[model samples]
Target chain A: MGVTSRGFAVLFLAGFAAQPAFAYKIFVSNEKSNDVTVLDGDTLEVIDTFEVGQRPRGITVANDGNHLLVAVGDDDTVEVYDTETYERLHTLPSGPDPELFVLHPSGNPLYIANEDDNLVTVVDLENRSMIAEIPVGVEPEGMGVSPDGSVIVNTSETTNMAHFIDTESHEIVANVLVDQRPRFAEFKSDGSEVWVSSEIGGTVSVIDPATHEIKHKIEFDIPGLRPEAIQPVGVRITEDMETAFVALGPANRVAVVDPETYEVLDYLLVGQRVWQLGFSPDESLLFSTNGVSNDISVIDVEDREVTKSVQVGEFPWGVVTTPD
Target chain B: MMPARFLLAAAFAVAAGGAAAQEAARLDPDWPCVQRKVPTLTPAAIWTGPAIEEAGDWRDDEEVRELVNLLSQRRVPQDEAEATIESFAEGLPAEERSARLTLLFAGLFDTMNAERSEIIEGIERYARHQKALVETIREQKETVEVSPVGTGSEAEQQLFWNLRIFEERRQSLPYICEVPRLVEQRLFALGRAIGTVVSE
Candidate 1:
């Protein structure tokens, strides 16, 4: 084989070899209990549970994977905790009522959705200052930053629009009107399209990233489920961009879809009121936060079976794992 | 010199108004029920309600009969649910039963009023916060030339749209008229539950 072909073979093998020996931990923010539950991702056992703040909801690991950032909406601050020691670190200037946020790829800035204030607060993590407060539609919540770090998109719950905010300039470049109660926004790994899930609308709008126009909408129907029950919330797309998963809020099922063809493949039954989802570092497992049941259903990604359900804190809202 | 029919009609109207007033008056003013619904906000808001659901677990189209039926099935075994309800109703005195009803009516009334209060209060708070955000945006507009893709006017427009929604909801509060019917239905359910409790 030529040198280019040999290099491709070596890189592919390296990727497969790196899948094993993945050490990571999962952190869940409990909205009612005002605490976070940290778990061992491999064993699915609780490592520790500690008080973070009041009404903790959105959570994610820091870009460096050293700290866990918990968006405490009631406390109006994003609390940071050390990943190694699980100790309380400093807090960041998250705008009023920070519900959800996305970290820029470069990792210094945080874009937060201030639901009550109707603004997207951009914070500079290193300087710890409010860099820019970009006004969005009513009840800004789900945030998705582009893989290239050039732009980030936010979904407004009340205004029902997917707003494209330019990262460098901190301005909303485009607004695409969506259905009622748009809850979460997810972009493909390739940055080709942005998928926005509307909770009440019960549809996912796939928008063209370049033109800010909706190319298509993916709809769902379950055999015995009522139409209202199929409320879509969280969305996740595989790295290969071949598959996508959407959490149907009250339906207690995750709709697995083919991203390429936009086909609904199957619905995996999860716990009650599945609101958010997280994938294991290696993509072998997916964890879902069932708000009503107060437990998380762990789905084996390959087998697509709900292997186990871990009882967590009351009304769990957000889930994230340390970076691989 | 007024006709008997006119006097009767006047009496009926007065009775109706009194009944309406009593519906919302179930909770004593001091009973922590009439207190502000927002619950003191932190000087800085920490976290907020789910963006998908501003009023958690509250559906605008909720019906009283549906709720009562659901609550009737809770924790109580289906076979024994009616008997359990009947026994509880039988144990209470007639006056006590009436009092429970009053409290329930108060609860239902407070519920609607609380919802109304939340919308009003939330809008007020939104307005206050929106002002601050607009000020920040204005400063950014002056200092930093906005992105090549968007202008500062777009951000302001979003805020304007949000405020308009709040104002619309505020004005339509009285017309939505969700509370009075809700109170009547809750009482209806309470009566049914009582009947079940006292039944064999």
Candidate 2:
């Protein structure tokens, strides 16, 4: 017993010493609470919750890792905050009801999906000015930028299409019809494929980037559960393109799929109404924001299991991790 | 109009009891909305002016019944509704104004709560119907795939049509989800509009 305690002390000291290398923070936007819950990425413990504007739905860490950008939908603005102090820096103008957004690979311009106005608002992060408002289909909610920063896609819930826009031109290049209520679009790291998740259609359509045609529709079936319960929403593919994780909203599970085969590998049962997901900087862990349950589920990526569930604020919607 | 706005704000505060309370109160698993699944709202949730129990039979009063019907319909704008309430109370005797307005609120609350409950039930039914159709669509697709139905064949065409119709129905869910909140807001506004006319 004495040796065990001494060994644990040394390991704790080692962890504290190595904090600089792996020190990161996970920011979760709670929609109802209108605040962001910040957690220590290493310990997976809540560090703080900072209040923001009304209806804070989408949140992301700026590429610089020094600032956090949150889409306050009701306020019709994207709020910027200091990452370390959780202080409000300023607000960027967005179109009405900005639900989700994505930063360019170069990290200068940010693309926002204005659901109410059916437009994608692009803003220059450095200057904090509106760059352009690219019109898309009805109720644009999901925003995705390609790895090369050439193309950005916005999924419209009512129109049921994935509208791809060229970043440089800020114009619609292609409108590929997917299943109904496509809530999210995720591009593979190599820019070879784009995966869009349809919430009501209950499938993820894999579109070929070059051909702009859907190559596969990945459907999930969990035994004893009705098909409608398996509503696909947020999707994320690993950097290596070996695996993909799709958040099955209201099904209370996350489906793991083989990116190459488009086959369901496993389902990790999470909290109630899991809508969004994020990955740790090293991709060692995946966190799911369970809106109804008001908690975030920590998934061990290597082990393919939920390791822990941490309670958060009300109606947690979006999540992003700092790269530091 | 000022009092109506205040009541509307109060109603929202009551409804925004956080997601944890919502989860605890929600019993229906198939509810598919971002808003809390509140089956019904009690008078205490929004009313703050007077005791509703002593309001008496609001339906028996012809004037109160007519006003209730008009106020319950969300088509009437809140400002217009408030003006109507103010004019009605101004015509009433000063001693009877508070009692009459309280009766008005009781009538509005009862009628709106019932409407909201009905809408919630309808939403649940819609979800159940969608679930059944999803199964049917899956089976139909499998049959079309297994049979010798060529592309553009009748069986394949039927499957395509069903899928399209299914999606069209699914698209209405978001709009339908807004109805309950709309009813609550209107009720709160009208209730508070009457409150403004009553003597403290």
Candidate 3:
């Protein structure tokens, strides 16, 4: 079956199930703790914690359900683990200072944002080797692959531009200027639009995925909270593409917005220095890793309230959900 | 008190001598070359007892010759600057003490490159000291818990006092290291600043 057809079936089953058919598993990477904590999504309890290399930041379950990939920033390598048993399988050597990464829909090409080199390194997941290094601006971070698997968007911290790279030719197709310190790009499920969050600029820029042009800018306002506090780090869109959650670093909250109107619906305060975020397999709950507090804030997506906070590891940073 | 006072006097005399040498060098461009052959005039060496004075054999000594060459030149030799500064620090005035000490440290930078032996040794020493204090406090606190119940005993009180003193000392080490590290860092900044100045 095609990838979209498979995704549709999963969504259909999830919609019909009485209690979210998919088993929700939470994967968290602790930057200072140097480990990954796996939590049972339904129970909101830590299931297992496993040792990873130094300074594990961004983590994601690969397109194939069996493998887990974590960016060990300090070690300069992405360690893959067997998701079923949570066992360390093997590690792929990434470029200098790998911070964040995204897997292509094909599941074979992995694009990593290396912060120090300010470049994106494209690696072939099948061969487990680097294929290309595209030079970016200062401190290139936060990556997203278009749903069509034709383009990849990388945001650089200092350059304030969202770079679009064509996957087929491995060339930068467009450099669209956004805001300062743009991080965490997320594409809609249909690949119609891409949303980029600017942490320092205190705004979210929604862009046309095809044209690489800014569609609209969403701004936030709260007294005593400067634009810096609203430093948005993580961006995630719902399966239906109706809602989006942007984790505001240092602002200590996540802003829920309507994707179509680009309007802020609500702001759910989570924890100190909130960095990365993820959703349950069923998409009913959202989990955010609070870097300073070293805990995960669980939010009920329907009500948009933080129901509970589960302590994880020291300086928890990145979080992901495993497919049932 | 006496030793400290004597060291202070000796430090001032050395500074006066250095100032005089600096003036003389300014007057005569060739004074440094001529002074290279002469012996260093140190208060300690000059004020040796009557017996040494009667012997009259203070000519061309390696230490004196090294010191003179270090102090008489417009720019001290990179190799001998550290030792010269160390010796000169003894006679520095109270207000100028830290300044001269800083200069002494700056001289060390001339001979050192990144990750040089002395710099690494200083860092290692600071790290080891911090680690030792942390471990010592942990062990002492463990002893306080595991020791036989004797809160009223003198030994227990002594342990309390010792622990308190250790804690205070441990708290100050970071500040102590900060002073030297800040000085060194500023020296590095000054070097960079000079490069920028020259480039502009």
Contacts from the true interface found in each model, as a fraction, amount to: 0.00, 0.00, 0.00
Q: lDDT: which is higher, 2 or 3?
A: 2
**All candidates in order of lDDT, best leading:** 2, 1, 3
Scored by lDDT, the top model is 2
Q: In candidate 2 chain A, where is summed lDDT lowest over 10 consecutive residues?
A: A221-230
Alpha-carbon lDDT, every model: 0.71, 0.84, 0.70
Best-matching candidate per TM-score: 2
Model 1 / residue B139 / CA error / Å: 56
DockQ of each: 0.02, 0.02, 0.01
Cα error, residue A45 of model 3, in Å, equals 0.5
* lDDT for each residue of candidate 3 in A135-221, tens digit (9 for 90 to 100): 988899989999889999999999999999999888998998998889879999999998898988888899997777898998876
Q: Write the per-residue lDDT of candidate 1 for residues A1-324, one digit (tens) a residue.
A: 699999999999999897756568988888988888888887898888899889998898875899888899988999889998889889999978899988888877889999889999999888789999999999999999999999989999999999999998888999999989999999999899999999999999999999999999999997645677789999998887767899997677888999999999888766666899999887888899987567788988778666777778888899999987
Every prediction's TM-score for the first chain?
A: 0.92, 0.94, 0.91
Sort order, TM-score high to low: 2, 1, 3
Off by over 4 Å in 2: A1-22, B1-200
Better of 1 and 2 by TM-score: 2
lDDT of 2 by residue, A46-106 (tens): 9999999999998888858999999999999999999999999999988788999999988
